[model samples]
Target: MNNSKKANYSIKCTVENCANHCGKEQYCSLDCICVGTHEGNPTMDQCTDCKSFLLK
Candidate 1:
């Protein structure tokens, strides 16, 4: 039996202010890329802020 637990991986920003659509390895827009860097979360894989984040 497999006892290993599967990791629920998902993209998430650290800015806490941005609302961009972060995917497993992609951002919704370029703005999110900039903001993610400014917010000290430069990790492209883990975006947290984005200027082009649309609130829907």
Candidate 2:
């Protein structure tokens, strides 16, 4: 049996809307962290207006 453990990296959400302070960046199953295309893209400012992110 392989019992290797996976390393996890946590990202703290500075966004006031989100209740969770610290969470996994890429490992978050419930929430997804992706890159933005434009300079004003909300996802780029994860701690500001992530709710306005437009996924393409």
Candidate 3:
């Protein structure tokens, strides 16, 4: 994982374990992120997920 990369301020992230997360910063390193929901009809924040996340 290259934590030296610059943060994409457009996407704020706090999941330090994600490969796309900006090191020590509250932001994502990717230009964009994919968002998805496990539930067919998502009704809560918990139902939504960061589909772009990859294990670091």
Candidate 4:
């Protein structure tokens, strides 16, 4: 993947530690992302997680 490419403005992100994160922009490089929850019955944002996140 071209990690140096411009950010996908539609997918806003702040996790610079993610491999898909645009190096200098606060956005995700991917065209889309997957969101999932760790809890069986998620009721809050904290209970959810970014399933597409990968360690940089």
Instruction: Give model 3's clash tally.
Output: 0
- lDDT, each prediction: 0.38, 0.34, 0.91, 0.89
| TM-score of every candidate | 0.21, 0.25, 0.91, 0.88
lDDT of model 3, residue 11: 93
> How well is each residue in 1-56 modelled by candidate 4, as lDDT tens digits?
44666799999999988989888788998889999999999999999999999998
Best by lDDT: 3
What tens digits encode model 1's per-residue C-alpha lDDT throughout 20-48?
A: 44333232423223344455535564555
Consecutive 10-residue window with the lowest summed lDDT within model 4:
1-10
Query: How do the residues 1-56 of candidate 3 rate in per-residue lDDT, one tens digit apiece?
Result: 67688999899999989988888888998988889999999999999999999998
In candidate 4, which residue pairs get closer than 3 Å at backbone N, Cα or C atoms, i.e. clash? Answer: none
Arrange candidates by lDDT, descending.
3, 4, 1, 2
Model 2 bad stretches (over 4 Å): 1-9, 18-32, 40-56
Off by over 4 Å in 4: 1-3
Models ranked on TM-score: 3, 4, 2, 1
Whole-model lDDT for model 2 versus the true structure? 0.34
In model 1, which runs have C-alpha deviations exceeding 4 angstroms? 1-35
Best of the two (2, 3) by TM-score:
3
Those runs of model 3 whose alpha carbons end farther than 4 Å from true positions after fitting are none
